[model samples]
Target: MRADARKNYEHLLTVARKVFTEQGNDASLRDIARRAEVGLGTLYRHFPTREALLEALLRTSFGALAKRADELQASSDSADALITWLQEIIAFTHEHRGVIAPMVSAIEDHESALHASCVTLRSAGAALLARAQADGKARADLDGSELFDLIAALAWLREQPSHASRADRIFGVISGAILARRP
Candidate 1:
């Protein structure tokens, strides 16, 4: 790309991320173009659709999350790795409010551009979950998909950071139910 075009592309992406985070998926494309000081055509030239923009904005974070899960799984205990990964997912969602709903839907829609990223995010902690279950540390019945929804639930409650205590209590209950009971 040419220098000016590259500059415009980068600026639009930065502005779009801010606008989308502040106003959500329904954030106006024209508003994004105005904020980026670019034409709507330019924005469209770079991102053909709103979902495309959303996918672009989320890709790096999801990639980082997958990498983090790998690193944690390699270095941490089975159950500990899964817990740490879940917390990181909650943190990621907090950074990008209103994104979870789209992600949840896209993950189930194989045709969505964001679907693969969601799958990567889901699979990240899944290995740890499997490892824990196999090691007799976690419940065999629950899988990573359940943990995925649980993390999303925690992210949805992020407005009340003070709810950490309540979250911890709930998580404790879940852990007790999911952890293997020794004789």
Candidate 2:
């Protein structure tokens, strides 16, 4: 891309992330274009679609999560590593208001722009989960997919206005279930 084009792309992405963070996925593309001082055609040329824009914005985050998984797998207690990464996943979900909905959908729909990254994030968590299970810290029956879903559900619950305060307790209950039973 040309220098001007690259600048516009990065500016659009910055404005889009701000708009989405404030007004969620429903935020207008036109508003993003306006804020970025770019034309709608330019935005379309770069992103093509809302999902594409979101995928572009989240690609770094997904990569970071994968890297975090690698670090966690060796950094400390297996259970603590899993818990820490789970919190990061939760925080990532909470970064934008409605992102979790699309993320969940993307996990199931390979046609979605975010599908591959979502799978990568899930597999990252799964590796940590496997390590936990191997260390006898987590339930062996639970796999990475299950753990990923559990974190998504908990993150969604944490966002709910009514249940928000109890999220830690809810997370605790789920965490307990994920742990192996003493013989």
Clash pairs, candidate 2, are none
Q: Report each candidate's C-alpha RMSD, comma-separated, in the order given.
A: 2.4, 1.3
Predict model 2's lDDT versus the native: 0.89
Off by over 4 Å in 1: 159-165
lDDT string for model 2 (17-40, tens) is: 889999978799999998888889
Off by more than 4 A, model 2: none
lDDT of 1: 0.82
Per-residue C-alpha lDDT of model 1 across residues 26-91, encoded as one tens digit per residue? 799999999998889999999998888889888998999999988987865787777777777877
Among these predictions, the greatest lDDT belongs to: 2
| Each model's total of backbone clashes | 0, 0
What TM-score, to 2 decimals, does candidate 1 have? Answer: 0.87
